[model samples]
Target chain A: MLKLMQNEWMKLWHKKGTWIMVGILVILTAGMMGLMKWISLQNMGGEMTREGMIQDPSSLGGTVLLLTVIVAAGIVASEFSQGTIKMLLTRPVKRWKILVSKFLTVNLFGMFLMLIGYVVYLLLAMLLFKSDAGESLSSWSVWSKSLYMLLLSFGNVFITSTFAFAIGSVFRSSSLAIGLSLFIYFTGSTISALLSQYEIAKYLFFTHMDLTQFETGMMLVPDLTMPFSLAVLAVYIVVFLLISFSTFIKRDVTA
Target chain B: MKPVVELKNLSKTIRSKKIIDNLNLSLYPGQITGFLGPNGAGKTTTIRMMVGLMKQTEGDIVIEGVSLRDNFEEGLSKVGVIVENPEMYKFMSGYKNLLHFARMHKGVTKERIDDVVRQVGMQNRIHEKVGTYSLGMRQRLGLAQALLHRPKFLILDEPTNGLDPAGIREFRQYLRKIAETEGVSVFVSSHMLSEIELMCDRIAIIQNGKLIDIREMSEARESFYYIEATPAEKAKQLLTDGGFTVEPFTDGLLVNAEQHQIPDLVESFIAEGLQVFAVQPHRKTLEDEFLEMTGGGQIAEAYAK
Candidate 1:
């Protein structure tokens, strides 16, 4: 299994699109920080501080999610499109092992991108913004809060990319996976809000997708706890993974 | 000799239609077997099942005495496959592509990879991207990757689909050498009857999802002598009375006779006042036998004579 993941990682980096993705992620993170600095300099908004921006890393989450979704969707679907799936599936390794390795590789790439994006966001925030409330950069309280926000933001990226991966593997089309995943990410919260008064809203995965809502005390559905939301998201992730693995292992691989 | 691979009562059905019937076949070491059939006669489907690309609805495939259903990885570890046009990671170099596959099989070292690369004569271009390779080069790389683990059984589908004459000849010699020196069993499916005739020791014909015939190439075929004589009428009558089932061919009569009896028969025809213009042996080609076996089925570009 470790060998298989090594193989997957090698193939992933060999593509030009992967490097392009990393470049785009860095540029976008910098651009977002620069735009915020410009907004503050124009006296058009309240004072922006490094600590304040560090605690709200959700701005980078959308970019990480998009990049992760692209990788996840293509990791399986591109094999079929490139007609390389035959060579891949005909090896001595079992089908489930191959699928698992690809899944793990996709998440690894997502994490790597997230780390890069956060570092860029941090450096730019410190360089371009001041400490409005005189908050120390090396303080433990600020670091933990920043890290916690990053973790919550990653949760949203993880769930969305898994959904895309499942769709891509089951349908064997990256475009559909990316399109459907982005659609759900953009509209899931609004749909949950529309049905917030109903009991079914609590059971919906969209209601729990953004775990950061618990930190901000902005509950989409009333009386939802962090543990309850985690439980619901766990079930959704398991279902998505089950669908991906079963379909991948049982596929005919005519390509 | 014990067989290296066996297919027992294998069957597949898709959408209420049987794509492959209950089929059985066995492949032995040090032998090269040819698989022949018309399009959609389940040639690709059977190959897919053997390699685990498709599941069989019934029966089991046993390789190296291990059932694929019971344990697929162990059974397939000894097998190597190059399904039609081995699609590789075009972005990576040929060496990396080989390394990628090497990681999938156990005990395939880096030295083994270099050895296979040299074996396929791709040492010069091994470091180049696969996207820059020609079809022949890609075919050689395909063979290189398949042989990286030194498999005991090698399965190739249309192995010579895209190659020059020299490349085809070289590839054929390579397959023959492995089968002989390493005692590897080979299964090749091709639409080119002539290629199969030259490369295979035995041929298996299938039609309508069923195995129709399996024959050894070394088996003696019936000898035929074409005699063209004028006063063709008297010649025909003489051969008809000579206890031979004579069939009328172009400008002559085809007599099913042995080699030693030919001179006497010519002499008898001369005495009957018939002029023997042409008397020579006619060996039946594999194409004729294939057409005859498949009931003149629609062969894809096989009748390009």
Candidate 2:
């Protein structure tokens, strides 16, 4: 499985699009920070400090989700489009193992982007901006808060990409997967808000996708705890994976 | 010789329609077997089942003594496949593409990778991206990847689809060398009957999802010589008198004769004042035999019934 993941990673990095993704992540991270720096320079609203920006890295979520979804959508679908799926599946490795490795590699790519974005954010925050007068940027609470926020931001990326990966594999169309996943990501919260009064809202995956809502004190759905949300997301993720793996392992590779 | 791969009562039914029906075949080591069938005759379906890309609804594929049904990875590890065009990751360098495939099979070392690249004569542009490669170069890279693990059995579907004549000859020689030296079993499905005629030692023909015939290329076929002579009737009479079966051919008479008796017959024609314009050995091509077997690529009468 590790060897298979290595193969997936090698294929992933060899593409010019993947390198461009990383470059975009770094540039966007810098651009967002620069925008924040400029906003602080304008001083139109209340003071925005480096510690505060680091503590809430939700701004990275949209870019990360888009990038990760693009990759997850293509990782399996591109194999079909490129006609390499036959070459890939005809190997000694089992079908499920190949699917799992691709899944792992997609998430790994997402995490790598998240980490790089965070590091860039951290570097610029330290280099170009000052902390609030009484607070140190190196404070343990601030560091933990930023790291935790990064993890929560990644939760949305993880779930969205997995959704895209599942749809991509099952339907064998990258465009459909990317379109549907992004559609869900953009509209899930509003849909959940519309249905929050019903009991079915608690069971809906969209209600729990924004795990950061718990930290932001903005509850889209009332009386939902982190553990319950985690459990619901876990179930959704497992269902998505089950659909991906079963379809991948069983479908005839005519291509 | 024991068979390296066996398809036992294999069948595939998709959407209540039988694509391949109870197919049975065995491929021996050190022999190249050609698979020929018209389009949608289940050649690709059978090959897919053998390589585990498609599951057989019934029966088993045993490769190198391991049943694919029981141990897919173990069975496939000993097999190499190039189905249709060798679709590669055009985004990657040829060497990286090889490395990616090399990692899938166990015990394939970096040295083996380089060895395969050299064998395919891709040393100069091994590091170049596959997108820059021509179709011939991709085919070479495809073969290189398939041979990376030194498989015991190699399966090729239209293996020479895009190669030039020289490349095809070289590829044939390479296949023959591997089959001879390393004792590898090869199964190739191709539409190029003449190419198969030249490359394969034996052929297994399928029509309407049935194995119609399997024959050796080296097997002795009835030899006929086309004799184009002036006054064809006189030549026919002379050949019939010589106890040779004579059949009318275009502007000639086809006489079934042995090579040793050909000179004597020619002498008899000269002595009898028969002008023999052309005398050449006429052998049926694989295409002719294939068409005859498959009934001009139509649905067989048996199936139609």
Candidate 3:
């Protein structure tokens, strides 16, 4: 299993697309951070501070969601597209092992992106601006919020990759997988808002996607809780994996 | 010779339509076997099932005494394969690609990677990215990857697809060398019959999902000579009278006689007042036999599409 994961990791790194995705992540994060800092510096409504710049919402969601969708969508769909899936599947490994490794690779890559992006943006914010958020930027609340944002980014990546991975596996079209994943990411909040009247909307995976919202005690549904949302996300993960692996095991590589 | 791989009554059905029907075939060690079939004859389907890329509707593919159906890991570990185009991560160097594939197999050292790289003659550009490679170069890199693990069985589908004649000749030699030196049983599927004639020891042909024939490439061919003599009708009569079957061709009489018998026929032609221009041996090419077997449907054209 470790070997399979290693192979998957190697393949991902070898792809120009993976590096391109990372570039997009870093550049966009820096760009978004810079813009937000400029807005804060204007000091029209809120205090402008270096520590304040690190707390932008784009760390977890927004444009980063597109990168996650792409990374996720390309995980399995590009294998089929590029015909490297045959090379992978022909090896002495279970289909599930390969699938799991790719799943692991995408998430690990996402985590890496999150951690590095956070640290770099943190450093850049400290270097570029002066802060008055607390006695120091390392205050417990700021650190806690940064950690919360980390969890939220990971949460978003986990859901987006699995959903997109499932779509890629079943549909075998990266464009379609990415297109639909991004569509859902962009519109899900509005859709969930419209559907919020229904009691069942609270259990929807998208309703809990913005994990940072839960940290602020702003539950989209009154009954929504972190534990309940985690449990729901867990179920959705199982469903996505079940669909991806089952289809992969059964489908013929005639093409 | 022990069978390195065996397909026992393998069948595949799609939507109630039988695509591959009860196919039974076997491959032995230290030999190259060609899988030949016309378009939609289940060649790719059977190959897919052999490598576990597709599920067989029935039966088993046994490799190195392991069942592909019952024990996939054991069966597949004994084999290395390249199906359709030689697809690799184009962004990676040829050596890195081989290294990645080597990770899938146990005990595949860096020595083996370099050895296979040298074997495929990709040393100069092993560090160059695959996207910069031509089709032939990529095919060589693909072969290098397949050989990296020193698998007991090697399967190549349309391996010579984009190679030129020189490339094809070199690739064929490498396959033969691998089979002889490593004792690997190689199964190759190709529409290039002339290539199969030179490269494979035996050929298993299929049409409409049924194994039509398994031909030995080393089979003794019919001895035929084209008598290029003038006044050929008179000479043909003399040969027929002398108890030899003589058939008139476009430019000469085709005599069903061996080389040792050529001198006597030449003498007879001289005796019949015919000018003996030349006698040319009529070599029966594999293309003629393949056309005869498959009813003139060009198999290569199917894949060319």
Question: TM-score: which candidate is best?
Answer: 1
Which CAPRI category fits model 1? high
As a whole number from 0 to 100, the lDDT of residue A195 in candidate 1 is: 97
lDDT tens digits, residue span B1-305, model 3: 78999999998889999998899999999999999988888899889888888999998999989998788888888898988788988888888888888888888999989888888888899999999999999898888878787799999999999899999999999899989998999999998888888899999999888899997888898988888877766777788898888877778888889999888878877877889887999876888777778886755556667
Over the stretch B1-305, how does candidate 2's per-residue lDDT look in tens digits? 89999999999999999999999999999999999999889999999999889999999999978999999999999999999899988888999899899989999999999999999999999999999999999999999999999999999999999899999999999999999999999999999999999999999999778898999999999998889987888888888988999988788888889899999999999998988799999987888788878877755644777
What clash count does candidate 3 reach?
A: 0
lDDT digits (tens) for residues B71-160 of candidate 1: 999999999999999999999999999999999999999999999999999999999999999999999999998999889999999999
The per-residue C-alpha lDDT of model 1 at residue A152 equals: 94
Q: What is every candidate's C-alpha DockQ against the true complex, given to 2 decimals?
A: 0.88, 0.82, 0.72
**Alpha-carbon local distance difference test for all models:** 0.93, 0.92, 0.83
lDDT of 3 by residue, A83-190 (tens): 888887888887888888888887887777777677668777887678674657667776776676777767877798789989988999988988888877778777
Q: Pick the lDDT winner.
A: 1
Better of 1 and 2 by TM-score: 1
In model 3, the runs with Cα more than 4 Å from the true position are A48-59, A127-141, B227-255, B258-280, B298-305
Task: Flag the better candidate by TM-score, 1 or 3.
Answer: 1
What are the per-residue Cα lDDT tens digits for candidate 1 across A97-216?
999999999999999999999999999988998886677877888889989988998999999999999999999999999999999999999999999999999999989988899898
Q: Best to worst by TM-score, what's the order?
A: 1, 2, 3
DockQ of 1: 0.88
lDDT of 2 by residue, A1-255 (tens): 999999888888888898999999989989988988888889975688878887888889889889999999999999999999999999988999999999999999999999888888889888887778877866799889988888998999999999999999999999999999999999999999999999999999988988899999899999999999999999999999999999899999887
